[model samples]
Target: MANLNLTQNGNFSSLAPIIPAAGDDNGRSTLIFLGTGCSSAVPNAMCLIQPSDPPCAVCSQSLFVPPEKNPNYRCNTSLLIDYCQSDANRSYILIDVGKTFREQVLRWFTLYKIPRVDSIVLTHEHADAVLGLDDIRAVQPFSPSNDIDPTPIYLTEFAMESLAVKFPYLVQKKLKEGQEVRRVAQLEWKIIEGNHEKSFVASGLKFVPLPVIHGEDYICLGFLFGEKCRVAYISDVSRFPASIEYVISKDGVGQVDLLILDTLYKTGSHNVHLCLPQTLEALKRIRPKQALLIGMTHQFDHHKDNEFLAEWSKREGIQVQLAHDGLRVPIDL
Candidate 1:
């Protein structure tokens, strides 16, 4: 029943009765935040090169401090779902390998000792989401000599089409009969139907897709996963269709233990991503036990805004806050 039974010095607090204690270890898993910034990334390069008068306070602080030390320093929006099997095995299912994916892997994955990526799910074909598909090779091979099976990547057909034009080799491997497989990433693209809310299995775990509007006519997917505990994730989006809203609501089809959604700015609306006002509204409507806002830009001052969100959480009776890179929340499956 707990949304977050967490770590990293209690950044995650339990909202609903603590998952009936540790005795019930049925579907245990850990949700790790690989990165939590928007496409440009926190401390935008332009902000660093072309300075503002006083300089953006948040961007200013992002420098000279590692993201581990400062939550303000973000790479890209990504989450790693580490599912522990009842048989003592574990699988790593990564969501959205963005442009900063390499940086995230070197930073958090190394620190967390994430051995390998078993599967990958792309939110969309945006550069920030799928450009790092090439870098998957560095983490895939268990041995340097032999060629392994291509890692399964689940994505929408539109995204797959985009990748076909952008990264053709990754989709259809151009290997000669005797050629080696050590150059690029070995990948198998699996299309996820975006027209309807369908449940797909990645690594022995079921994931229900929640489709929402990205820009105007384009649709991006959010996912609903978990057995013992339900979790909903919508990383990049502007608005949800009526069907999406109801599907995620408690009275609709199901409920969420943890809701991870997108928020790009502190106040105004964005053409592609959700702003704070709309994010809060969605939280109110979806009514998850707890929520974490992701895909933030420099306009968001982590410490300052988190303080405000803390108060908002208190008043609204929902434990929602800004999710930072390196955030690890242990959750029930």
Candidate 2:
């Protein structure tokens, strides 16, 4: 199983949340889960508002300790891929800076000593994904003496249209006459087609867009990205189209090194997200060497669910587990 192989080796363990010292990522790329919960996130506010007699085990446990110590405490789904180029340029490519992006930065960014965000890619225009773009300046701060360079933002035309309506200033900055530029986010919107065959470069790494259907008709994008290790990420997906399924399946591009997928619940159905059974089917078909499920709701108790995954991993011969906030896994690519 992946967990057994994980503990015995240091290659790719989903449970390893070891914080790297500044400038010491151990000479390899890293994949950090800034947040691993669904749009509502774990510890749902409605769960507490409409108090149950027994209360929610996951939400209740979430408050028992600080976020760092509580895997049950989760935020909007987000990921950070940090890597260094052959030119020694360290890049931080953030995927979907969500509503909780600032809070995540306060907690994980400081811990990881990430200097700045080199680029950003929006999965779609969902509020959970793009609401945090207003705070881009924090990731790459400008000084009083110099003008800040514009950070590149990659998105689909549909996503760009949404952002234009949501935050016009971000898509195109408006400077007043004779008004000095103060501290503000300088952003460069780069629109791209979310086609499976089309690949785009962010900073130094190449990313193949894995466009998947999100509810019934809505299209959301996931990505197959890696510089050294082949990592495929699909944070929000309901069902994979036949073509997409083939793209990630063992018979298609062959098994990926790591697969980060979405699982909205332990069982049952979600109009816009995959359930546990669906996730299992995906793991079996993709047959990734290791897998980590994200975009969870409050129904899952972190420790308990992870134990189940470990057992399931053993039975299935794939290392898969429930990922939590602040979880850091090492990746070669």
| Alpha-carbon deviation at 333 in model 1, angstroms | 0.9
Q: Model 2, 1-333: lDDT tens per residue? A: 225222321223333223223334566778889999988877899777887888877787755677788888999999998876776668999999899999999999998888889999989999999999988878776665337788898999999998889987666566668866566577888988899899999988899999999998899999998745678899999989989878877788666777899999998988999989999998998898778889999887877887888899889888788877887776567
Model 2: lowest-lDDT 10 consecutive positions: 4-13
Candidate 2: Cα lDDT at 290: 74
Question: For model 1, how does the per-residue alpha-carbon lDDT over 1-333 read when each residue is reduced to its tens digit?
Answer: 333333444246554543333323355678889989988898888888898998877888867775678888888889999999778589999999889999899988887789999989888888888888889988977555436788899998888889999987677656678866656788888888874457789987788888889998788988888888888899989988998888778767776767899999888888988999999988888887778889999888877787888788877777788888887776768
Clashing pairs in 1: 227-333, 228-333
Residue pairs clashing, model 2:
228-333, 229-333
